[model samples]
Target: MIDRSLFENTETAFELKSDSELERAYFLFKMISSEPLVRIGTAATNFALKAHLPVEKLIRATVFDHFCGGVNEDDCLPVIDKLYTKGVSSVLDYSVEGKSVENQFDNALAKILKIINFCDEREAMPIVVFKPTGFGRFLLYQKKTEGVVLTSEEEAEWGRIVGRFDAVCKLAKEKDVEVLIDGEESWMQDAADDLVEEMMRRYNKDVAVVYNTLQLYRWDRLDYLKQLHKRAKADGFKIGMKIVRGAYMEKERERALDKGYDSPICENKKATDDNFDETLNYILQNLKDISVFIGTHNELSCYLAMDLMKTHNISKEDNRIWFGQLFGMSDHISFNLAAQGYNVAKYIPFGPVKDVMPYLIRRAEENTSVSGQTSRELSLLKTERKRRKL
Candidate 1:
């Protein structure tokens, strides 16, 4: 059996971090553990950016440098290479969000396509990711999700969105690089699901070239995956899924309350954990037909996945299964798993500092909201620091 205490090895976990970097990680998590600080800091950062205050350098040096790889793809090469030396791969995510223009969509598409090309060239990068909204407007997706009829102009615009998805997936297929399409709000996910399913049908005939994310915080996602599996089997195509506990729980609950509808999110954190584990088991049991990218920072969920893989007799190096964590957090899980020869990748968010604030702010808020997440990070960093006598 694999070592149950594998993740407790601080030496293996923080081997790549220098003394100063370790202290920085500890300090960052300490700050994130306070809920009020995250709220006030988020507001202040947003205001500063809008008022043209010179906070970009401060952000870049501290949170941005820690959470993000760099400001662009080329700038990320050294980080990508560094992680690879320790057996972890990198997924370059162009994380600028909330754009609603044709040119912006085109720029996002160009960025992803370029990242795919980078994946093809670099052995350290085997996968690329994009958000559905990155290729089109959010309202367009919401309208289609709610079954509203689109005007002719909206239809033409959506057609461009489809073209963008196709262009990336096609290049990904040609280059043999895996593509992960991120999940968003449930109010607009139906349309995104249909579009991604179509991409899977086109590019995943031989392998899972295009993957759709499943935010398992939604209780219905396992059923959704099961139904999608039936369709994939009937149609003779593979399935790729990146499953997460989700990133928008507060927004989801607020929207449900405002609209007088049942929340799509699981009733509570425990339910979400159960849902994630159940889905993980299902995917591991059906690994031959479905590939999974397990995106999580929870130690229990990570352990559950490792146990499931062992019970299913799956190889540690299986390409169809990967364990992923965000770039700056969860180094214990990522490096420990990689040290044990399990397939692992870190989602490395990259963009200009000002443009990436939304993503960074969300990260900070999520760290504060998720119980024990920030504390676990701090605890691990402390352990590593003590081990190093820092």
Candidate 2:
């Protein structure tokens, strides 16, 4: 269990700001903790067209303020500086999703390349990330796995996708920054994995500059990691992988049941947790051949990785392993790990407010659905509130 007092102690290693920040944080916590508020807010925005409501303003004021850096890159600098001062780094993610039109895809490609260029110019940005679904149609990615070849126009569009990824990878390699390709739904993941593998082969000959995300909630991801490792060894290049319990578990399970197929998710949470830790151990053991980012909010899993690092006599600054959590949800973990001299970063998402509502809703739903996490946050806030005697 994480020590609640660690966060309560303002002078502790993680460095909470003056009482003012904590007070503001507490107010935000109270808002998110209200089930009725979250339910109505989610419903209003989710069915806004039918509901004919303008709830984006409320969303922008509450959850957006809590979770996102801002709606774009320039707006994220203050948040980046705040985290950096506390010893954490930031991963820049341009969060535009679900684009299908070729020109729109091309424009997103340019925007991402620009973000990478900006990162190249900044000292604080260590990683640049993008979701494949952000750059292409989901159905097209699904089609690739079915052995359905694309038409001439589709092939040209596909080339543009490859070109965009290549541009990002090449710039990352040149700038010595890491590029993390976010994982997508399972139906579209095979194409993403293939694209990442190709980039890793091309750019990872000397160092790991390209990483593919692995969603371990999928029952087969452990073996997939092993296979990726084998391929990396055969190709004589270091493998880069980011491991998570997964972001789409509920959707994946529901889809599987609806389609009469076995769910790819682990049979139980214990299995998922076990597999996540086991995979961490596997990557640690092969640290020379693989670089891993342990992207999880689970405390035990985080500690297990830390303990393993110590057992192996690995330096806290070892570039091969990093610890990351999303921007707002796990500041306690991210900041505390950074204070301990570990390589840690927050995944900072930036985009227009309207464009990123889906991301925002998913975050709210995640916190609300995860048993006890909100309660824990509430408990921490109340503890701190008591500490301050407010």
Candidate 3:
């Protein structure tokens, strides 16, 4: 049986965090716990960034440093090496978002290819991540998802997008690195899913080289996974998945309401949690055909995964299963799991300070909106602080 209190070990969780870093984390979470402060901070930061009023230094020292690995891949090496010392791996995430041009798309593809090469060289980094929209325009994906016929020009553009995906996934396969394609909003997800499935069929013939993100908060995802599994089995391929409760909850619900369509999101938090756990169970039961990266910060879910693995006679260090949390959040879950000899990886977001603000702001807003998330982080930091007599 897994220990119920494994995640409460502050010393193991904060061993890498310096005394000042612990205090900074406590202060950051305390500030993030206030919804109003988060809203105001997000607005002010965005305005300051647009105005070019020199807030980048302040943001870099505070939230950016805490949440992100660094501004570039080279800058992230030290951070990645340090985490690996604790037996945790890293997925280098190039987090620049919102590109609309072909040149920008090519740049994103080049960055990912470079990261895959980087991952190949570094023992600490076995995976790389990119968003579907990062390689092409969001509307292109939306058009494809809605089954709308595309113009010749649009088709040519999308062909380039597909080429970009192929380049990265092909390189990852050659280098023996895993590639994770992040999931976006429900409207654009279908096209992305179809594309990722193709990549999996091609590169996952021998092993899982391509992973698709499944946002379990979407009520239809478990069915989607099962269907994908059946197809993979018949086609002689493996299914690689990174499952999460999801981001974009507010946007998804609001869009569904505005369009008078049923929300794709589960009806409530309990339903989403149950859906995540059930999906986790399903993946664990089919580990031979499916490899999962369990992306969550919930301790109960982590404990549940541990218990299930034990029940299934799976070894703690199995390569087919992994636990992942964001770089700045969920130290308790990530580090504690690593200490217990489970495969754990941190998603380390990196980009220029200005370009990464949107990702960081969203992280803060999500922490504030998710009930008890910020409080748990603050409580853990406080416990560590008291233990160190700070």
- Candidate achieving the largest TM-score: 3
Question: Where in model 2 is the C-alpha error above 4 Å?
Answer: 1-21, 34-36, 46-58
Candidate 1's error at 154, in angstroms?
A: 1.2
Tens digits of per-residue lDDT, candidate 1, 95-137, equal 9989999999999989999899889998889999999999999
Better of 2 and 3 by TM-score: 3
TM-scores for candidates 1 onward, in order: 0.98, 0.92, 0.99
| Decreasing lDDT order of the candidates | 3, 1, 2
Residues 1-390 of candidate 3: C-alpha lDDT, one tens digit per residue: 888989999999999999888888988999999989999999999999999998999999999999999999999999999999999999999988888998999999999999999999998999889999999999999999999999999999999999999999999999999888899999999999999999999899978889999999999999999999999999999999999999989899999999999999999999999999999999999999999989999999999999999999999998889899999999999999999999999999999999999899989988988998989998888888888995
In the range 1-390, model 2's lDDT, one tens digit per residue, is 333443334334225545665666667666666778878877877787346577767767766766788888889989888888878888977776767787887788787777778788777788888888777888878888666888998887778788888988998898888988888799889988898899999999988999999898888988988998898888888899999988898899899999999998999989998889999999999999989988998878888888899888889999999999987666667777887789999988878777887787777777777777777766666665676675
- Model 1: lDDT of residue 50: 97
Question: In what order do the candidates fall by TM-score, top score first?
Answer: 3, 1, 2
Q: In model 2, which range of ten residues has the least summed lDDT?
A: 5-14
Worst 10 residues of 3 by lDDT: 381-390
